[model samples]
Target: MAVVLLLVSPASQALDKARMDAAVKAHLALFSTDDIVEERFAQRASAVDLDGDGVEEILFMATARCVGANFDCPNELVVLAATAGAPGQAGKRLEPDVLAAAQTGYGLAGSEQIPGEVQAVRVLKGTIEIAFLAQQDSPVCKRSFSTDQGRQATTHCPAPGRHTWTYRWSRGKLTKVSS
Candidate 1:
C-alpha cells in the first residue's frame, strides 16, 4: 500500500478525494457491480513527479473480482493517473491505451499476448515501475461486458509461462519493458 502525500496545495484535500473517487468509479465501470468485488479496490494512491514539473501526480490501480463461475473480469488491472489541480479541475485519466495494449497481448513471454497482472507499483529514481505477473495457472484478464441490448463474453487463454514483465513510466504512460 502506497500512501502518497506531497507538497499539497490548500485545495488539494478536496481535489485528492475527488480524483480518488473518479478512479474508483472508472474501475467500477469496467465490470458489472455483481462481478466486481468492491473490497478489492482501495483508496491507496501514489503521488510522484510523473512529469517532473515540481508537482506530484497521483497514481493508483484497481482489480476486479473473479466471482461465481466466471474465471476473470476486466477488473484485473486498471491504473489511473491524476495531476495536481485546484478544487474542480486538474485530476485527469492518464491511461486508456493500456487496455488496448493488454487486449493485444503485447509483451507476453509466449504466444499469449494478454497483458499480465499488476503485482507491485513502486516509485524509484523518479520513475514509476509497475511489475506484472503472468500467472499462467491462474485466471488472467478475461473481460465480459453487459449492455442494454445484450452481453458479450471473451475468454483469454491461459498463459503458458509464469513469467513477469516490468512496465515503466515513459512520457506519462506505462510502456512495457522487454523482459
Candidate 2:
C-alpha cells in the first residue's frame, strides 16, 4: 500500500512584497521592524487608494502558524495605509473606537452586535465616505462625515460576518460618529 500526504505552503499564501513594501514605505514609516512581519510569502496584499491620494495602500490578509510570542495567533488581517512621499513611513493605527466597531457593532460605547466589513474609503470635498457592509448582509452601509468635524462611524454586518469602523478627525480630536 502506498500513502501520500499533501502539505500546503505558507510562502505561497504570503502577501505581496512589492505592494507591502510600497505601502509600508509610504505610510507606515513609524513602525519598527519588530511591529511588522511579512507572513506567508508574498500573495496576500491587495493595493488600493482608499483616500484617493494617488498613493496605493495595501490590504493584506494571510493565515499562518503562530511563530511569535507577542500575538496569540496568526490568523489576523494586516491593514496598511500608503501615503505619498518617503518609504517605510508608518501610517496611523486605527483608533480604539474604530477598531471596536470593526470588531463589533453599536460603536465603541454600545453593546450591540453587528457583523460587517469595511469595503472602501473615499474622500471628496473634505468629506469622507466610508463604504462598508453592514448588518443583515446589506451592501450599503454608506456613511459619510466630514474629516474636519471630529465625528466617526462604525459598521457591522449581520450575515456575511465582516466588520469595519471609522473614526474621523474633528476639531483636533478624533470622535465617533456612527452607532
Candidate 3:
C-alpha cells in the first residue's frame, strides 16, 4: 500500500476558519443545510495559490451532497479567490476550464479508462495533487464455500488503490502535468 502525505503550504496557513465560514455562507443556498457545508469544508476544502497571486485561494472539493442527492451525484471543484474588500472577507467564486479538467480521470493501473472518485487534494511545491479511488470490477463472494473437512472458506474483496493527478499552476491557469 502506498501512502501519500498531505503537506500544507505556508500560504494555506493564512486561511482561517472565519474566512472559510464566510465563504460557505456566501454559497449557503447550494447546500441543504449549514451542517453539510461545514462537513464538506472540514473534510475536503484546501487552501492554495491557484492563481499566480501571493494570496491563497480556497479549493473546495464539493460533492453532490452540497445539493440534495436525489439523483446522480457529481463532484465539483469550487475555487474561491480573494476579493478586495475587508481584511477577513470571503473570496469570490472563480471557475476556470482547468478546474473541470482536473476532475476528469485518466485510466487506472491494469484497468480500463474509468472515472475515479476524488478522495483528496493538496498543494505541494507550487503544484496541485488530487487523489482518487480507482474503482475495480472485482467479484464479491457473499457465501463461503465448504472445505474438505467442513471448514468454511472465507473470501475478501480487494481494496481500491489511490490514483493521483498532478497539475501545474502557471500564468493563472492549471495544466495537467501527470497522472
Pairs of residues at least 3 apart in sequence or in different chains that clash in candidate 1: 64-75, 105-113, 105-114
Q: Which stretches of candidate 3 lie over 4 Å from their true place?
A: 1-13, 28-42, 66-72, 85-114, 136-161
**How well is each residue in 92-164 modelled by candidate 3, as lDDT tens digits?**
4434432232222110011011135666777887777777774453121112344577746443322456778
Please report, as a residue range, the 10-residue window in candidate 1 with the lowest summed lDDT: 104-113
> Tens digits of per-residue lDDT for model 2 on 17-119?
6545543333332222333333332223454443444443344433332233232223223445322243222585765434432332111111111123445
Candidate with top TM-score is: 3
> Judged by lDDT, which candidate is best?
3
Candidate 3 global lDDT: 0.48
Q: Find the number of clashing residue pairs for candidate 3.
A: 0
Give the Cα RMSD of candidate 3. 15.3
Question: What C-alpha lDDT does candidate 2 achieve relative to the native structure?
Answer: 0.36
Comparing 1 with 2 on TM-score, the higher-scoring candidate is 1
Please, what are the lDDT tens digits per residue for candidate 1 over residues 1-179? 99987675643433345554544555445434563343445323554555555444455554544555345543333344442323222464435543432322112111112345666666765445556665544444545556577767655543544445445555556655644
Ten-residue stretch with the least lDDT total in model 3? 105-114
The lDDT of each candidate is 0.46, 0.36, 0.48
Cα deviation at 25, candidate 3, in Å, is: 4.2
TM-score of 1: 0.46
